[model samples]
Target: MDFLNYTEGVFATNTSGNDSLETTKLPTSKVLLTVTLSIVAILTTFFNCLVITAIAVTRKLHHPANYLICSLAVTDLLVAVLVMPFSIMYIQMETWIMGKVVCTIWLSVDITCCTCSILHLAAIAIDRYRAITDAVEYSRKRTGARAGAMVAVVWLLSILVSLPPLLWRHFSEEGDLEDQCIIIHHHLAFTLYSTFGAFYIPLLLILILYYKIYKAAQTLYMRREASRASRHSCMTNGSMIPSSFTAGDGDIDGGPRSPDPISPPEKSFSEPSTEEPPREKVRASVKAFKRKTRRPESRSESRRSQLYQGPRISGSRERKAASTLGLIIGAFVICWLPFFVKEVIVNTCGSCSTSVEMADFLTWLGYLNSLINPLIYTIFNEDFKKAFQRLVRCSNYL
Candidate 1:
């Protein structure tokens, strides 16, 4: 038993020496990986800081929605500051260098921060769904206090999900796990619980809310299109009845009529007046007829179309907001789904495994969501972009 032993074809141990395991290092140069991770860490920190600063300084962004966005930015900022640096080291070194206490703290922060970030995404989705589907009610309900309450709940749930491993302390010897900071999966029940609470359920909620939001947006869009078509139809109908339409020589009070008969009247009908009507009198009669016959159909139709003005503007703004929310939700799912699904698969199937590289890639993909979030949610927002520009220019408040 004094001979060296290897497990999983990747980790090696020597029986004669103090217990230790040698994990295989990546074939690529460590320098490249280090540089890449450093860049990502810096970008994550810098961009998230920009979002925080932009929101803080922008007075216009002081609403409940932006408040939630600021909370999200804070979560991402903490991830960048507390998780990514150590994670980069872990990935490159292929082992944990931080001591037990630091390792525990790192893992907790990592899980808590990411969980909070995801929950914030769900909260934003719910906010958008309400804001779209029930604008008046949601507006009255969406206050800073409520947003703060939501943020509190998000962090509390995140803490709950992240604390079980630390509390259980499943490792038989602290020394054995000193080199690695990972979830202890032997506690299968808690692992599943934590994973479900942290990822699956939140994802389900987000999907449901966004689906509803999408339906509401589609309805609004269809309604607008229908109204537009109706307005067009009205215009066409109103235009078809020309204002210049004139009757043949007949009474103008009614529709077009036939001309008088050419045959002479009967002699018994009494002799017709021989004198011709005066030109002024005939023109006056025609003028009276035109005045009596002219209708204000075009004016009335114009007024009817004008009635849609308020709703049209409101619908446009709603469509814009829904589109923005759609983009945010889309980015969230694309960035996090793979990682969460992989996590579920790996944890659910005991024999399932993932290589260090694939695991890191998936984790980083999820982290990339933090980076994409600000770009979609804030940078793309007109008000936020204006505020950002103002901040950059050091412009005085209006």
Candidate 2:
């Protein structure tokens, strides 16, 4: 989140002199900023906690895919609880009054949690792609243990990506650092590694996986629709045959008439007509049996309801794939891309620099992603919606 420049930009305000004076005389803008960021922190925590609670309480939402969501919510919850408040205080005070120990903890947790959140998105994209593209095989593969393992991997990678900054920043012996909590990254390579590992690479992977999922969803949906259409047509044509067979069963009248050999040539034709009733009965019986055995819900709906619980997952899903794909991609990119891009540019270009205000804006834009994550992940799921409603109702009752 351009945090390297971010610390400097914010701290630069107080680094000159008179930190105690500035902290006491808060500006209107800083007060407004504090209020705004405090609300953001509160909402971020509230929403992510709702997500975790919803997943935990709702048995219907207990699918392997949802496990990843719960983990993401946990990571975002950490961001809100552990990271955002400190950032807001820093913004308000314009200096690091907190001790070095707290700064070390804050910076480490900040990078780790944010990196974990981004990696969780990538993991979710992979799980959905597998479910859509390989439903049966993936169904077996997508278990609680597997989801746990995925979460573990995401956290491991996050820690690995964040470790360099945490270790280096913690051990730094730079003087006059008491007023600042900046992680001064001297090597450009670390910036590239951490940024790409934390945001860029995962986002690129998610985009590609979602694209593949979109195509697979389209194919499966069309196939299911065609199957339903063919079944409907067969039933429609069979309806007429059932009516004709009704009297054929009672052809006690027709059979008796046919046996009257007053015109023997007619007897032969009537005999063939009598046999047609048995064949029609078999066909009608088979159709009824098939209908009885068929599931109430279609395979497509069942599979997709478990997969993401987003939409129809067939006709409407196909039509809305672009929108869903775009929203997911756009939210993440809009939130994170500019900050990372700025980070790269500033790191690579010696003279290029971003103002503190611009850097803070970009950083918060990325932090907003923690709030956005739960909404995007859970809003479409009816199970989660119902669970949230129940929770809210219970909360009100209390």
Candidate 3:
């Protein structure tokens, strides 16, 4: 009886110890979250890398619009490389193991990349608007020096915007716990910086640019339709004449009759033939119209060739590239808006109880934005998609 009691007590103790250890392990929820975020980071990194590679290698994609896409790819690639790895490590450990220097770098990279991306999107919109509305003038005016200046301006603005956070000591303080470099969120500063610099102004600019583009496109389309209708009317009106009338017929009111029965063949041929007269008139008119049209076409074609012959700007691929950029920017806004809104509420509403878990989840959700942009471009943009497929095929063969 004594032996049995002792064995039972040992078993109970062992079970209790096992239960305690299990409870002490990180929460299952946290483990799952870490796993999910790591997966997202890996996927985002891979996809952005592919985008960069495809754009770099493809000869046909060297237009100005492609330049913007390449810029976006670079930003996203930086996000995946600089920001995501730290994020995954932080999430997995449930702490930031990196020291202050590394944390500052991460924060700087995050802000710079994101700001540049948004700015690039705005630049793309502006480029497209110019291309569609002021196509002729833009073609004549936009030179390499001009485009280069624009790019430099964008980067300079991005750097300026990103610098303030780093300079202001927003990220210098160590976390209260062992593992993280937490941001010192000053409510007023956060509100002003994030709202004005990141979300509000950028979004407002995008809206205005897109609205203007839509209106301009509509007006141009209307004008094109009107011009086509007017041309058709002129052609129809010019073609119509009494079937019996001929150039040499002298049928005008009170006009004298021709003197000779021996009508010269040249004059006779020049006169509209009675049989199939309308058809012949239409054919002659069409031939004359085509001859006139050829001059403009040749000039435009020469100009287009000249423009493309120089250093490839990828600008020719503007429409698809612009749409791709818009999707990325739109995605960024959608993904990050909720978190920013939460930040605002937390800052303003003193009574609101915010949890670390909630903040982490939202942050990870924002990180997911990095993974989506490359995929969005690949799926929607034909040039990128083809380039991607070609790359894959090349890889498989190799």
- Among these predicted structures, which one has the highest lDDT? 2
Alpha carbon deviation, residue 49, candidate 1 (Å): 1.3
Instruction: Please provide, for model 1 over 1-398, each residue's C-alpha lDDT reduced to its tens digit, 9 standing for 90 to 100.
Output: 00000111111112343323232343455677788878887888887887888878778777888899999999998888888888777766665677888877776787788888988988988888777676655667888999999999999998888776656654445325656665544555765777688778988898898878766666655554454445445555654321321222112112233322223322332223446457756666676556545534545555467545646765776777568767876787788777766666666676777665566777777878877777787766778888877777888781
Per-residue CA lDDT of model 2 for 253-285, tens digit only, reads: 012111111112111112233447887767766
If ranked by TM-score, best first, what sequence of candidates would result? 2, 1, 3
- Candidate 1, residue 221: the lDDT equals 50
* lDDT, candidate 3, at 109: 80
Judge candidate 3 against the unseen true structure and give its global Cα lDDT, from 0 to 1: 0.59
lDDT of 3 by residue, 1-398 (tens): 00000111101112335545654785796577667767787788888888888878887676666666667777777877787777666655544566767866776787777777667667766776676656655655556456667778888888887776566555344223234444444456655665467556777777787767655544443443343334334334543221222222221112223322211222223345567668788887677667666754564454445434422333333454447556756786787676667766665665664555566666666667767867865577677888888888886321
Root-mean-square deviation of every model: 15.6, 14.2, 17.1
lDDT preference between candidates 2 and 3, better one = 2
lDDT scores in order = 0.67, 0.74, 0.59
- Please count the clashing residue pairs in each candidate, in the order shown: 0, 0, 10
Using TM-score as the measure, the top candidate is 2
User: Alpha-carbon error at 364 in model 2, in Å?
Assistant: 0.9
